[model samples]
Target chain A: MNNERILLVSRPKGTPAMSDFRYEEAAVPELKGDQVLVKTIYLSVDPYMRGRMNDTKSYVPPFELNEVISGGIVGQVVQSLSSDLAEGDFVIGNLPWQKYNVVNDISVRKLDSNIAPLSANLGVLGMTGLTAYFGLLDIGKPQEGETVVVSGAAGAVGTIVGQIAKIKGARVVGIAGSEEKTAYLKNELGFDEVINYKTDNVFEALKAACPGGVDVYFDNVGGEISDAVLRLLNHGARIPVCGQIALYNLEKMDVGPRIQSQLLINSALMKGFIVSDYAAHFEEGAMELAKWLMEGKLSYKENIVEGFENTIDAFLGLFKGENTGKQLVKVAEPENV
Target chain B: MNNERILLVSRPKGTPAMSDFRYEEAAVPELKGDQVLVKTIYLSVDPYMRGRMNDTKSYVPPFELNEVISGGIVGQVVQSLSSDLAEGDFVIGNLPWQKYNVVNDISVRKLDSNIAPLSANLGVLGMTGLTAYFGLLDIGKPQEGETVVVSGAAGAVGTIVGQIAKIKGARVVGIAGSEEKTAYLKNELGFDEVINYKTDNVFEALKAACPGGVDVYFDNVGGEISDAVLRLLNHGARIPVCGQIALYNLEKMDVGPRIQSQLLINSALMKGFIVSDYAAHFEEGAMELAKWLMEGKLSYKENIVEGFENTIDAFLGLFKGENTGKQLVKVAEPENV
Candidate 1:
């Protein structure tokens, strides 16, 4: 079968450009023993992918040059040699940026679409949800009536984080890039206060918003926003750093005001964690998040760009703050649906 | 009785100067109900006192101007009007920088000099010891075979921290400002490695010393030393920030490389703490530390300056890195001794 795929042609110096990726056609080989042939339905474009694009020692290995950029992909099984997976089944796996993939059954998990929308598994009920779940509850540990400040509040993880803090009876304050994004967080997500960081003096706005001082900070976009929040921390404050989208694209080292003294004076705690770090408790986290969704206590949004060709554009748009929620590309639709 | 006291005549802009303190003579008033007149024996000159000197928000309130600068003082009960303490009893309390102080009986704790030397209560067996105990064991929970790096390794708290980490079965590396301090740490304290940050390129030296990577960092000195340590952190490294002596004298805001991204990528934990945070468990910490001391598993040193007139000079020498261990002023000798 003919397969369309995108390969990383060059490493980005700062923000990635279109020339960095090369779209081409390739051939997919026949499935062998215990192997399954899957056609890509939806491909996720996340900020974390940017880290893997750089050749650095991080939690995950960097993407190889002239190779298909790989990430979370939802696909439909067209052919299966393994008894574990059946034809016409929908599954999700960390797969390449390609139209068709030949994989072993262990590489993908079968998904039941009756539980929620197929795309929701890529977002609110998936890695994004779990990232917010464990980072906030396990690390941030927001107490009732305490104030929680969330950066990147309109993004997938940040939206879930703010909602979870609210569910735990905290006063949620969100920091976002645009007025429209901040409005969405306050209006739809029940954020008690929202700061447009692009337009507002973040330090003053945050000080005004958190009158009692910030007790828990869920940091998604680190940099100046984090520095300002560090200054206003209450005694024994907790900061769970899940992402640093603000510094991911920088070509040079990131420099700013040091935080050790502030943390020292406030007696605060800051921890960094990835979703897979809590893989053993994934069932518990996902079940609780799903229950919240079923009870109408949680809300989520997705920015879906149609066609496989827009995947690069969708991924690049994340740095520009163009997406209000989980951003994904629709490579194809389930044939059964 | 005649009392000689030093008062904070003015606040220092950057580094404290002699003009900031005023020494004067005052009369000790008659003891009230349950009050005791205590004569100062040894005065603790700690790095944390620098924070209290500034009129800013911190864990402790700033010292009032034109008033006696109060801190840790070991005194002897000269006259007692209460049953809690008696004449000739050696006691310790947070008291003013005065030769004699009249305080309520509840303010001081009677020290049993038979168990250990009186000065040990101010250095190895007192608040300084407790600070090292809780901050290391609770926050920087170093596991066996891991590399534990300590900054300000020859200081009171840092010395104890290195000893405790060694007791916990971790390999200990100490960073100090002088060759003499590093030699003391390596030769006397049995540190696995010692980095003389004064003469060495700290980043390169640390890299060579910790070939495996730093697992637990007990940071008593922050700034560039911490930045270098942060770069070489192993995954899930723990940092307990007990003090920031490096930035204590800065007149302007401290600017350096932001650490959130590094923390995010490594999944590490950094917590700032004071000894009092674990107040409820003080007895447990003190007991364990005392056991180590009694077993000869721990060793401590103190830089004692004789005479009350040298008290200000002794405190000022801390910023200049003049002391080898716990810095104290011997205001008077014990009558019995």
Candidate 2:
């Protein structure tokens, strides 16, 4: 069978273009001992991937030139070897951008579709959900009656964070790019207030929304949005730096007002973290997130594009704010199911 | 008796000038019920006082115009109307910058002169020492074998912080303005390495000193100095924002490279704190610091300018880096001693 994949041909200067990626067709090889042949079902494309495209030192290494771009993928096992034999089973792993992956069994986790939808393993039941869970609860730590302001409120992690803040009995204010996103956050997710960054003066609107001042800030889109929120922080405020989607494509380093004096005057805290830092607590975090999902306390939205040929387009769309929530590409359906 | 005091004649625009203060002679008030008379002996002039001189909201309220500039003062109780104290007792209180103060019994703590020098109550064993004790141990949390860097290393709090980090078995690096101050940090305070930020290339010297990267940063002087240190932080680094003496004199807001991306990529934590935040544990902190002092494990330095006439000069000298350690003005000596 033919295994078609996408390779990163060139690094981007600012925003990535179609020419940066090359589509290639290769023959699938026979599965060796302890290896599993899986057909890709869904693939995750995130903003952090922008960092990996550049040849720089970061949390994750930059993607090598002319190499297959790899990330979180959910697939169905077509053939397996070793004692954990499975000819038809759903699994999730960090695999290459390909239609079929011949990977070691240890890299993939067998998923039960009976618990939730298969595509959810690539989103709410996956890394995105866990990111919000740990970063908000552990770092943000919104106490009851405190105000929580979340940027990128309609995206995968921000959506969950807002709902969780509401669950904790805190006043939740969300900042997003569109009126539709603001409406969904307030009307559907029970957010106390939502600010449309594109249509409204974020600083004045935010000042009006949070009258008591911000106690916890879950930052997803850093830039002027973060700079505005920081000006209104109360004493002992906590800011969890989750993502800086705004500066992902900038050719030069970001410059802004230095915050040492602000932090010192308010005695505030700002911390940064990645999801894998909480690896030991994954089981606990996943259990709580799943419980919230089952109890209707949490609702998630996924924006999926059909076909493997459009994978690169789907990935590039993230930078343009084209997707309202988690962006994924659907490669194929489980043949056995 | 005449009670001479310094009054804030005008608010400063940037750096404070001698003209902003007025030396006045006022009548001494008679001691009332429950009131004691304290004759000021040693007066503390700190970098944080610069903020109080501005007519803006801050951690402490701005000093009222034409009022006595009140701050940490050590005095000798010359007269007492309360049974809680008697004459000849040494005490510490936040009193006006005056030759004599009429205060209530609850406002002052009587000190035992035999424990240490009376002036030590204003510096090493007092607020400055407590500031270093909590800010470094609680916020910085330097573990053994880690690299700890302290800015303003010749200042009262910075000197204590470097010594405490050394006691914790961490490699300590000090950043100061002059080679003389840097030499004091390394030779007198037992710092592992010292960088003269004025003469030496601070960024390159810091990188060489901290071969393992900075794990804990005690920031007393913030600005480009902090930016340099932030670039070299290791994974999970902790930064305690204690003071921003460098920016205290700026008339306008400070602008520099944003640090959110650096903290995010390293999973670092930066916290701003005032010594009073840990007030609940002041006794515990003082005990530990005092124990270290008595055991010869800790040493302190004070730069004293004789006479109450030089009080304003001593306070203004802080911005010019005139004093090495704790800067103080000696108003009067204990007659009984």
Candidate 3:
């Protein structure tokens, strides 16, 4: 049988183009001992992936030229050689961006579809969900009645972050690029205020929205939007930096007003973190997130695109502010199910 | 009796000039109930005071125009009507830039001169020491064998910070402007490395000095120097921003490469604080610092400019980086002592 996969053909310059990626087809390898043949159903495309595309040092190593891009993938066990897994079991793992993966059973964790939808295992119950959970609770630490501002509020982590801040009884304010996103955050997500960064003056809008001043800033889109939120931080405010999507595609070093003075005057704290930093406590965080979901205290959205060929488009759409929430590409159906 | 006091006659536009201050004479007031006459002996002149000279908001309130400038002052009780304070008692308080101040006894904390020099109350074992203690141990949290980089490493706080990091068994690198200052840090203070920022290519020197990367950055001088140190941070590094003396006098907003990306990729933390932020635990910090001093694990230096007439000069000299350590003005001799 044939397997289709995407390869990073070239390193992107300023903004990535279609020429940077290439699609290839190869024979599906036979499984070895304890290995399972899993058919990929869905794959996640995130903003942080942009950092891995550049040939520079980051939290994660840069993607090598012409290598298969790997990320969060949800699949079903179509064939198993060991007793640890069986056909029809749904699973999730950090897998290559391909139609099928033949790997050792230990590489993926089996997921119970009864708890939540299988696709959600790639989102709210997965990486994006955990990212929002730990970043908001651990770093942001939004106290009751304290104002919390989140940038990229319409995206995967930002949407979940605002919801979690609201759950913590914080006065939640969100910043996004569209009217639809602002409306969704305010009207649907129970956000106290929402600023459309494309239309409104962010700094002035933030000042008007956060009358008490920002106490926790959950930053996803860094740059000018973060600059505005930072200016309104009260004494002892905390900023949890999860992503700098705004500057991810920039060809040069990003520059702005130095923030140390602002931080100094306000006695504020700014910390950068990845979800894996809380890996030891992921079970605890996931449990709480699941409980919140079960109790209707948490909600999530997914903007899934159909077909494996569209994965590159889905990934590039993140920079253009195209997706509203978790952007995923659905490649195939669960054959066993 | 007459008292000579310095007043902020005008708000400084950029770097403060001597013309911004005025020396005034006033009749000494009588000590009322619980009031004691404090004869200013050793008054501290610090870089943080520069922030107060501006009309803009800061951690401390801006100095009101034509009002007396107040700061850390070590004085002797010359006259007292309060039963709580006795004549000849040494004390430290946020007192005015004056030859004498008649204030309530409760306003000043009595100092034990036998423990250390009375001027030590304004430097090590006092504000600067406590600043270093809390900022380094609490925020910087340097672990044994880790690398600590301190900017303005010859200043009052920086000197103490490097010593404290050393006590923690960390490899300490000090960055200062002059060769003399660097020599003092490396030869006298036992810093692992010293970089004269003015003479050497700081980025290259820091790279050579910190082969393991920086785990803790005690940032006393912010600007380009900090930018260089920031680039060399290890994953999970902590930066305790103590002062921004380098940018304090800028006529316009200081701009630099936005640091969020650096902090993000490394999952680092940067916090800003004043010594007063840890006031609730000041005694605990001061006690530890005092113990270190008594054990010979710590040492301090003070550049005392004689006479009250040189107070403004001593303060302005901080901008010029003329003083090696704690800068103070000796106002008068203790009459009772």
Candidate 4:
């Protein structure tokens, strides 16, 4: 089969432009001893993908020039040579941006989204869910009645973090960029307070909202705004470092207010994590997250851009703050289970 | 009995000087309910004291003007009103610069440093030991053969940290200001490498020392040096923030590069801790540290200045990097415990 894939044309110097990518059609290779042919259904666009566009040694290797970008995808297996997986199985795994992916069957985990939307495997129930879940519970360690503030609180991971902290009996405060998003956070998402960072003095608003100092800070946006929140931290505060969406556009990251001494004075716990760190707890995390979704205790949004050609466009939107929740690209229609 | 105590005569504007302190003789307070009269034997002079001397909020409250400055000290019970403590019992607790302190017996812990020096309780066997042990294992979480580097390497906490990391089978590197302290780290303390920050470019020297990126960073001195170390962190590096000796003197704190992004990209965990966080782990930590000390697996040094009048001088040496290990002031004659 001829596979359609979007290749990275250039490593971004700053925020990536549409010109940085090129769409190409290529022949999909035949299955190897353990390889499986997967028909791509959906491709996940995440903040981490921005890191892959830059040629820097990090958690994952940088995307090579003229190679298809890789990220989380939900695919349907059409052919398999391995005993682990068979044809007609819907599995979720890491797949490059393509209409079709030639993957090793062993690397795929079969997904049954009859439980919820399969695309959720990319957001609330996937890396986003696990990230928010572990970041809040493990890093934040929010105690009952404590004020927990999350930056990017209307976005994918941040939205879930606020809800989860609320579930844990914390007074949740969210900081977002839009008035609509802030409304959704306060009225619908159950955030006790929402600060529109784009319009308001975030520091002053946050101070007014959280008269008690910040106890748990689930940071998804790291920039000048995070510094504002740092000042209001109570003694023994916990900051869970998840994503820094604010710096994705910078060629050289800014030197904001130095936080080391304040962190020392506050005795804060600031730690970073990739959802992969909590792989040991994913089953429990996914199961519990699924329960929250089914019971309507938590809500999530999916901003789907149609067609594989728009994958790059969808990913580029993340840096621009154009997407509301989990940004994903649908490559094909899924067959009935 | 006449008791001579050092008082903070005036608040410091930025860097504290001898003029800020005044030594005067006063009456020793009589023992009351639940009180044990302690004759100060060895007075500790720690970097944290500088924070307490300033009229600012910190992990611990700041010392007021004309107040007797208090810190961790190993004293002997001269008289007791509580059944929990007896006269002449060697005890360790927070004591002011005064020659005598009437403290609640529950506030102090009895120290029997049988296999080591009694002064070890003021450092390695007490809070500093607990700080390094728990901070590294619980927060830093060093893996075998992984590279672990610590700043302020020859100081009391840093010495114990590198040794403990070594005991955990990690490759340890120490960074200190002076060549002598750096030498003491590599030669006397068995660290894999040591760098003199005053002479060497920390970034270039760190690149040379940690060919394999630093897996764990025990940050004692947080400043520009820490910024350089953050750049060399491996994926999933752990940072246990035990102290920040560098920023204590600044009248107004200057912010460094925003490290939250580096932390996120590296999946690093940076958490500040006061050894008291693991008060429950005291028995376990003390036993393990004691075992390491008895086996000659860990070595310690003390920079003791004779006479309580020199307490401010001893503290100022910390900012100047004159102290080798634990910085302390000897107030009066020993109780001969």
* Cα-based TM-score, every candidate: 0.99, 0.99, 0.99, 0.92
**Model 4 ranges with Cα > 4 A deviation:** A1-3, A27-38, A75-91, A102-110, A334-337, B29-37, B76-90, B102-116, B335-337
Considering only N, C-alpha and C atoms within 3 Å, which residue pairs clash in candidate 1? none
For model 3, fnat equals 0.92
lDDT value for model 3: 0.93
> Can you write out model 4's per-residue Cα lDDT over A135-246, one digit (the tens) per residue?
8998899999999999998888988999999999999999998988898888888999999998999999998999988999889889988999999988889999888888
TM-score of chain A of 2: 0.98
Model 1, position B139, has a per-residue lDDT of: 96
Second chain of candidate 1: TM-score?
0.99
Residue B73 in model 2: lDDT: 95
Query: Tens-digit lDDT track for model 1 on B1-337?
Result: 7899999988898999999999999999999999999999999999999998999998899999999999899999989999989899999999999999999999999998887788888988899999999999999999999999999999989999999898999999999989889989999999999999989999999999999999999999999999999999999999999999999999998889999988888999999998889999988987887788889998899999999999999999998989988999999987662
Checking candidate 4 for backbone clashes, the offending pairs are A258-B255, A258-B256, B52-B63
The true-versus-predicted C-alpha distance at residue B3 of model 4, in Å, is: 3.1
TM-score of chain B as predicted in candidate 2: 0.99
Q: Residue A328 in model 4: shift from native, Å?
A: 2.2
Worst 10 residues of 4 chain B by lDDT: B328-337
RMSD of candidates 1 onward, in order: 0.9, 1.1, 0.8, 2.9
> Candidate 2: where is the Cα deviation over 4 Å?
none
DockQ of each: 0.89, 0.86, 0.93, 0.62
lDDT against the true structure, per candidate, is 0.93, 0.92, 0.93, 0.87
Give the higher-TM-score candidate: 3 or 4: 3
* Candidate that would win on DockQ: 3
Report the lDDT tens digits of candidate 2 across residue range A71-152.
9999988888945748788889999999999988998989988878898887888999999989999999999999999998
